[model samples]
Target: MNAQAVRNYSNEFLNIGVDAAALGMSRSVVATTNDVNAVYWNPAGLVNIEDYQGSIMYASYFAGIANYNYAAFAMPIDKQSALGVSLIRFGVDDILNTTELIDSQGNIDFNRVSLFSAADYALTVSYAKNLIFKDLYFGVNAKVVRRTIGKFANSWGFGFDAGIQYERDDWKFGLMVRDITTTFNIWNIDEDAFATIQGAIPGQNQELPETTEITKPKVQFGMARKFDIGRTFHLLTEVDLNLRFARTNDIISTGLGSIDPAIGFQLDYENFVFLRAGVGNFQKTTEFDGSKSLSVQPNFGVGFTYKGIQVDYALTNIGSIGNALFSNIFSVKIDYSFFRR
Candidate 1:
């Protein structure tokens, strides 16, 4: 059974910035988010922020083997405009970097080790405005990304995102272009630089070659429906289709890949209690036994709201990635409306 999981984008850290509710809903939230979290998912959703809002979230995998943290704030610019800022950090600490040792006999030694940390981070500034036409909204994101592999190498990149949303009654439609500008990561350590650095290390004898990675644009299409069962009960159903663009060896040749879809549902009672469920991160593989299988991760979350504060918790199954351990995600958000509509 050869099973390999592929992350849609080379920037895997993008997967770590979702809100608790979105994570619980299998990430089918492009059209459902309405708060500061929208800064990461779909900036167009920021138009739903009434006055001002702020949120912070943290998620740990396998008892802190890895950590993901996110924070965001959004405020209205005017009756039809909103702006937001967000930050995301994901990383593993205390990683041991091992280098082969050589004895007098030129025998290999395995005791030499170095400790370092690896991290991926991003900062985003977003803006959204309701168009003059009906309920149409448009938004954009300007972001900077940094990735580091210990001290050996680091990369910096800049990207832009844009999104549009249309709402009518209880239905919402959304489309987002993630990394619309085709982000490029420039590494600090190239082959020539690595050759000089590696030569100075007593135990190192090989040079490292680094290549720039280009993250192509991705498109997300989403639709959601809100059902008001009664004065105290409500349900939300949503779906999102994600398509990624990839470039061939020529770099200039790009095309769309397979479409991945996600679905989720949320139930709420009196705006005080909320329940959410979702399944995503899908992949198809043929095991060593030559059996075809489809794999997807499932997550569940619950939330409480009182006054202007909301707390959300999600139990996410990490599948084999976490040795079958369940990961926990927690988030808190506060919203205030200077003038109630």
Candidate 2:
């Protein structure tokens, strides 16, 4: 068995993020996340939850060719601790499988074609606790990942995440480390199914591919603050710096690592109606004349809360400026406590 460790694009689907509100802010909620969605953004913020909460989100990518969905639930264990669970799915369905299109007689038949789906799934369990020190919290996550490509290949992966958050006089800071112990995926290929396609292409599909994949650690640092405007309006702002160990095309890159900075702001009226905007994913690109230029993604969102139900919508991009189509994401959050009589 040939084993290989993939350093780039391993478990890339997980990076798509969850929650319309977070995506709207270009994923800059590390320091300010406090609801069920915190399970994905920064688990440490889960300790701030006061009651049972559940959230669901859905988004279509690449002009509806791919679908992404997320759900999460969280509850306080006690005055000092909380627990959460989250699930994510990203897939492309109805893909035509042409490997079996040609039969023993080498005759082409449209009926021989079949449809399949390529999908990725992740399940995460999280725990958070308030520290003995005032205004400090810590959290950890254990996650399992599964991926499938029709009946030809499948993989299973496991990983861990840790986070910490501190607050002082209306100011918050947070740090989240994803895949802290390095995630590993073991793949199993169906040789029988793959053999049917060996001759489909002259040189391709000649051999089974690598079976092992490794995902390295990533770190994010965030800071947030809130200000009161007049009597009924409030404004919140947050900034996050995401760091990857390898050098890349981020705005700030070096041999040691690369940094991607994101900034998000939210304005609300009486905590009922909300508006948000963010900018991030800065990268250097080459123009037609060979001149380098910087590109960024900007996102906008709106939210409304009535009783204990919150609905949020965001317009975001899956690719860099002018390169990909924009997606509309929607999410709903429910506070179970609201139903109590």
Candidate 3:
């Protein structure tokens, strides 16, 4: 096959998001993220970490056929700067390899069958600093991505991201640019392993696949505000607009780009018990009658914190909106300072 650069759905695993809190909010926390998960959302929010923080999350997708995991750690460099590291992995394991199932004598050989996994991994290093301007913060991320498909092919990619956050009183705003300089992935295919499959099909799989992939830039703008309810309850609401430079099924689509809007709300009692809900992923779907209808995904979550240890749970795609299956996500966070006391 001719070598070509793929422009769509490259490195899509990164888009799955990290942390239960953020996913529960449909990733509307760009303006209010202030924990280890910020390493993936808006690194600029890492500056809000008071001390060393660590977080981990786990989720299963497609009815347990795939697994996703995330981990992150952040610490303050000083009073005005912070640094963080994060890793994400998404994979489907124990896939049966059938390429070698046929013996040279034209006999079926079940003994030769093997199992492998196809997985994608990403590592991000983030830095956030408080700017000279009051309530303004800046952050950047350096990312490395790796992908593997059993022993047949593998790829390596690199990218950069930049984000900024600004606050005025109870209102906050944020902007995040992913793949600011465009990300590129180069793949290497093993000819030996590929040869087995090349002959398995008459005309299909006769040539090598594309060797390059390009991920274009994407931007997200966010706004958030906090409201006080009496003296014991607080509500935080956020809205985010995700922009992609291609037409899609998003609610707002045009020739130049598409805009997908998301909104989230979080309520807390004395910052200890939390309840969250979000709506996002608006799309126009075609009905059986050739009519288009709007669909939205709704998510819900709950959390509890004690002694700086927080646990969160989220139910995503609650009603199976669109073609996505519902998933249950869980996450835990720990503050080192809590152990010091």
What digit string (tens of lDDT, one per residue) describes model 1 on residues 67-138?
888899999998889999999988899987653345447676667555778899999999999998869999
- Against the hidden reference, what TM-scores do the models get? 0.85, 0.97, 0.96
Span of 10 residues, lowest total lDDT, candidate 2: 196-205
Could you tell me how far off, in angstroms, the CA of residue 340 lies in candidate 3 after the best superposition?
Answer: 3.2
Per-model lDDT: 0.80, 0.93, 0.91
Best-to-worst lDDT order = 2, 3, 1
Give the best candidate by TM-score: 2
Look at candidate 3 and give me any clashing residue pairs.
Answer: none
- Candidate 1 has which clashing residue pairs, if any? 1-287, 1-288, 2-288
- Residue 101 of model 1 has an lDDT of 48
- 144, model 3: CA deviation in Å? 0.4
RMSD of each: 5.9, 1.2, 1.6
lDDT comparing candidate 3 with the true structure:
0.91
* Local error of candidate 2 at residue 14 (angstroms): 0.8
Residue 272 C-alpha lDDT in model 3? 97
In model 2, the runs with Cα more than 4 Å from the true position are none
The alpha-carbon root-mean-square deviation between model 1 and the true structure, to one decimal in Å, is 5.9
